[model samples]
Target: MASRTAPFSPFEFLIAWRYLRARRAEGGVSVMTWISLIGITLGVAALIATLAVRAGFRAEFVDTILGSNAHVTVYSAPMEVVEGSGVYSSLMRDYQVRAERVAAIPGVTRAAPLIRGQVMATKDGRSNVAEVYGISAADLQTIPRVANPETALGSIEQFGEGIAIGSGLARELGVGLGDKLKLISPEGAKTAFGTSPRVSAYTVTYIFTAGRWDIDRTRIYMPFAEAQSYFNREAGADEIEVMVEDPEHLEPLAVPLMRAGGDGTLLWSWQDSSSSFLRALDIEDNVMFVILSILVLIAAMNITSGLIMLVKNKGRDIGILRTMGLTEGSVMRVFFLCGAFTGVIGTIAGVTLGCLFAIYIDQVMSFVNWLNGGGVWDPSIRGIYELPAKLQGADVAKAVILSLGLSFVVTIFPARRAARLNPVEALRYE
Candidate 1:
């Protein structure tokens, strides 16, 4: 027997094409084909969109952490009381020297001594608790988020002269740049009888957003000297905030960083601070991926339905083709090609749409916000100002695999049914 024409040969493709393009009078599979194509397209596109959003959310979250907060915070131990002097003694007293030592270590980018405390901020009788970060004017400019002059309202030049406040806090207190706000501290002047709450008014010299909801809502940056006096840490800083060049790969420098901070100091990394949040994000991501995959599978079921209908309608034609010397394998290949073609085109279109959506997400959000007449995305609600989307190659590949895999799998049953149909029985009615 002349070797059966290799499966998926030119004639097989021609036959598949003709069947897919069947006219209305001949039992049109064309309508079903389009439905399957559209279903797959939407499914793949939705999968890509979900992946992009999750990637963007994680990226922005990490950015907020690194940009607005320190990678590692070093604390000086054994705060001892200096008798008669009425002051506490600690290794933090030599903060500048320790900061210099930490900064000198390899991979260490910045190390700044800062006094941190919580105080109540009041303006026109409205009061809110705020976290205060006391650092020098020079060190304030080192913060990445507030370093931008355009985004930072007022001036860093006068940071030390007064106090810098978060925009959220400012809004809550109804205070603007140059407005006077009073700060109340429980740790206050120790009188002969007892200590009294310290209250003082300060002008707002600068305002910043920090790209984080909680931070922007409660953070206040004061001068190092001012914070020291206010918090009664006049001898030294509370902790040394360190920024490394590669926070993600800090294992190599951990020993060095530890040695740099020297004895009597503790190291706290960012991972320690946000471990719970990160874990939740990872769990949510995995759950969302599985859920979206089910959606893709559901969409692919449409392909199976369409192909089965096509097979039933083309039963007579299949019988004629089988009698015309076409092998069962050739018949199966033809139907398989029809389904695969629909799947491949749908996947391509979906990928293109997904990438474009991710690339222009900012514009899309802007348009949506405009349509909604504003307040669509509140920073307070979402935790970030902008809606982010990041298109990743791996995510796209996964979507493609899911769509094609499901389509191919579902097509197999119908293709096999068509191949096994007996010509005699199929043409008995005819």
Candidate 2:
């Protein structure tokens, strides 16, 4: 026969489980047990759900930024110097060859010449400011969100014929496919009399949403040749926008990029340009985690209270068991099992619920939007069009560890008191 099991073997588990499941006319023990279970379940679920949403939102935010914009921008100064202005033009006049050289780098993916300008877009008496990007048919295909057939309403092949505006801009301007949208450029041909504004009409051949409110509300893409003529950049491009295989590890490529981009060319990465914005996002994530930790602490307190009441109600049972030669350590283990049982089961249930919620958040948000009569989330204010949630293993593990640790730590004090209770006094009081 096997050696006898330790004091906390099946005997302790059975006693703790019986106390947990025992029925009483007063309904105190069962009520406290249910409350503890529910509290722990809700706390863990809330923590997991909050973390999933933060992770998902961060991912979508970064994707929109990377998809709509270049990871790196190479600016080459023009040889022509302005007299008495003390300013040098940062235009890459030889952009064609510069783009070829940059694209050949090991990690470089795509390098395109771009001419960006701000203009006023008007249709049906409605007007909104728009940022125009002049890109080639081939280059436009590289933009993920715009190139995706699902998010884009029009064809990429037809992009060369007319201007492609964002979905938000089209909605705000009340313009549709094939409609003529007037573009008013402040920088026009300089004349002897004065500088006159250039107002031109272009058909809306394509419309797309970059999954970002600001991008969709303002960005427009024009044919490379058309933009060159319209912006008076026939000889050079404003900058060379470069894409790479790995945007997060762009530091290692700085020397290679600079060398290939030619002398006096300054390179700026997406991270460098958006340092403040990224820092704020980090702070927000930390604050959200800290706020949810309090909910878990409340659950810990609930466990402590329930176990203390349990010890009082089972005083007679403890006295009888102690008189029968059961050790104090065994009594402590029994009550400890009770608290740990509640935590383990509640955590498992909460993990399941939270994971399901994160996985189906899109469908859930759709129902919510429908119930609210179609305008629940405003992308312009929140940055993204829809709410997002992403489940991470690290977040789940952290929540589990936090819940179990709290359960075990809080049970110690209550268990100690039950063990120290005098058997004679407990029996006499009963």
Candidate 3:
């Protein structure tokens, strides 16, 4: 006896393809049908590309900031510069975070005391609010790089009275190297007359620009000693910045550092301080994914509708196949295969287009720039002037999986509906 099951062949895919072609020919695809497939293809492509862009940007921005800033900053709660004998000895007792006994810490590449506060920077009758960062020139390497290599870097080691100004601040105040600038502390001076804050004068020796607008617009660097003298804090710097081989160990070190402070100092991780930024990124990522995913789902719905119409148009053929000894299961599998075939083809095309577009998105942007007459890129309106796209296999795989999953899921409802049709009723209709 012959086997009941249909013989498996390498050309099964060809058969499925022919089935689809024949259906397309008989029905002559409507505009709505064309719209459905196009929608799915475009949505998947756009989502993949957008996700790649977001991932690229997040990685770039976060890594840049981390590279420039210390993993953690330890400061006094009352904003006091901590100083006490046996304090260093006591902190040295711990392996996690040792106090000023820097020699005791194994992973610490460099450690520096720092003072940070807001001060009015004035030059040539122009003044702007700037963040004043005080650091030991000797230990500046432990911190991230600043704009002026000579000022924040060169003089930090020299322990000079010179200061470094940010590019934006420098440009605004019209100050440059060898120029005089005034630092006015918000704290006032006590006197027989009304108390008033004292303003100190310093010579600007370096100009720095880190390329970040916020940093370039608002920061000034001064030697730790100079800042201490200016702030009238003899106790030491307001905080200690530590650099280590592994920044990820900051949390484990924080507990030990806190104990070392003996309730006097507070340690803040970069993540802890930048919680708002991180949270915003997280929210934005999820929102972008969810919103974009709707496009794919919408496309899937279109696929479902198209398949339903295809099944309706093929009812007579289905009846003929049933009469020719096709089982309900086989009939169902046929339509299921048809839907899956559509999904696979659409997904392949979509992913291919998305990957290609993402990889060359920067070139596309550049071409647009060329067309418009090249000039400085404007990020204000564009959100970002340069198009950055990172196409990770994992990201691409996830997107493909998600798109195919939606497509397959959409097939089931229509497949089942088509499968349950009574052969007699289907045949009688035609």
Candidate 4:
């Protein structure tokens, strides 16, 4: 009959761990070992910190794109006939149908019509190029998530010559709300000898800050009727903007959205519009990950080399253990566990240090700014002044997996060498 006893505790594993630590100290670390350890710690910390920053940037910009731009944009290549007297009102029925169909599409939230044009904006002897957006304020509310609703133009019923300007544009023109700004249509313009372009002024009723330099520095928002009047087209808007339920599936949905646009219209996804920029960002992220991973890999090599040296020093002990009936597998397991133990310790320390630094990066930056004078952390100059750290569980998981996998790979060589030791040869020296 077996005697009742407590199960073998995992705490017993610490004995082997302590032995490894003692042996590491007994031999006295060379300068190279110290450098290697430092290199590993710094490398792991850098990878974690960088991944956090990139993820934060991606999240912030995705929100900006969805907030300021449409989930999808539809363009009419040439004029298409609709129901009303002209296309604007006559096409209302078809427009409604298309919008409903878009909404029914998987992952789509809402769809609305939008008209855009390039026009010259002038105020107080200051004139700049600007792009104008014409939208129905009521329908806009339905898809407010696509663009920051706080920045939407005032009531559509009040479309009468009212306009909204971006914060950057507002700064450039030195204008305020209720102040009037002129919009000169390109078609209406004429050279001194030719007919001058049609020029009109509208009151600035709203100001928006979207943090996108391109949009904030060059966009104007107005009522659809006002844009129609300025263009003298009296026709429908130029395109439609769609809001999606899941932005990640945008690439897959582009085909259907394009089909819905019909022959004359061109359907463009955000990915299509910004493919080059997004690709560049992808390349940059990959490069950074690869470069930093090399440092971690080098640190792993240090652990491997250190373990190899230990095995050589302990050959006599290994031989004795073998003669004492310890299986070769157990012998390998002991060293494998020891090396894994070191990796776990190093990993825990690295992660703790990295997260702490990331969480306080903004405060650190602010302190540095203060020390340097008083303006080193300005957003106007740096683009984003706030130190943002988003600790994603996925990133942490990846880092741990990578560190452990590397540690395991590096341990294999020393483990195999230790397993091959001959008792007679090892005992000869002793």
TM-score winner among the candidates? 2
Lowest lDDT 10-mer window, candidate 2?
1-10
When summed lDDT is taken over every stretch of 10 residues in candidate 4, the lowest stretch is: 1-10
| Model 4 stretches with alpha carbons more than 4 Å out | 1-15, 22-27, 30-37, 79-108, 142-161, 189-194, 251-263, 319-323, 357-361, 364-389, 427-430
Show pairs that collide, candidate 1: none
**Distance from true location, Cα of 31 in model 1, Å:** 4.2
Candidate 2 residues lying further than 4 Å off, grouped into runs, are 1-7, 77-87, 367-374
lDDT of 4 by residue, 225-299 (tens): 766667654655667789887876777878888777665556777777767866776788789888888878988
Cα error, candidate 3, residue 216 (Å): 1.5
Give the candidate order by descending lDDT: 2, 1, 4, 3
Q: Rank the candidates by TM-score, best first.
A: 2, 1, 4, 3
Task: Decide which is better by lDDT, 3 or 4.
Answer: 4
Shift of residue 285 alpha carbon in model 1, Å: 1.1
Per-residue lDDT over 66-143 for candidate 3, one digit per residue giving the tens place of the 0 to 100 score:
655666676665422256432332121132243455424566665566777788888778989999888766565454
TM-score of 2: 0.93
The sequence of per-residue lDDT tens digits that candidate 1 reaches over residues 1-430 is 2155876789888988887786867554677788888878888888898899889988998888888889999886665467566665553888888899999998888999999999999988899999999998888899888766226688889887799988889999999989999999999999998999999999999998888888888999999999999999987898998998988776787788778777777888898898898899899988988988898788777778878888898899999999888888988998888888889888898888888888898898899989999889888877888889988989999999988998899899999999999999999999
- The candidate with the higher TM-score, 1 or 2, is 2
Q: 1-430 in candidate 2: lDDT tens per residue? A: 1134486789889998888885865378678777878887888888898899988888888888888899999987555456777667777778899899999999999999999999999988999999999999899999888887237777878997898999999999999999999999988877997878889899999999889999999999998788888888878798888999999889998998899889888888889977788788789888877877788778877888888989988889889988887778888999999888988887888788888888999888889988988888888788998898989999999989988888788889998889888899989956
TM-score of each: 0.92, 0.93, 0.78, 0.79
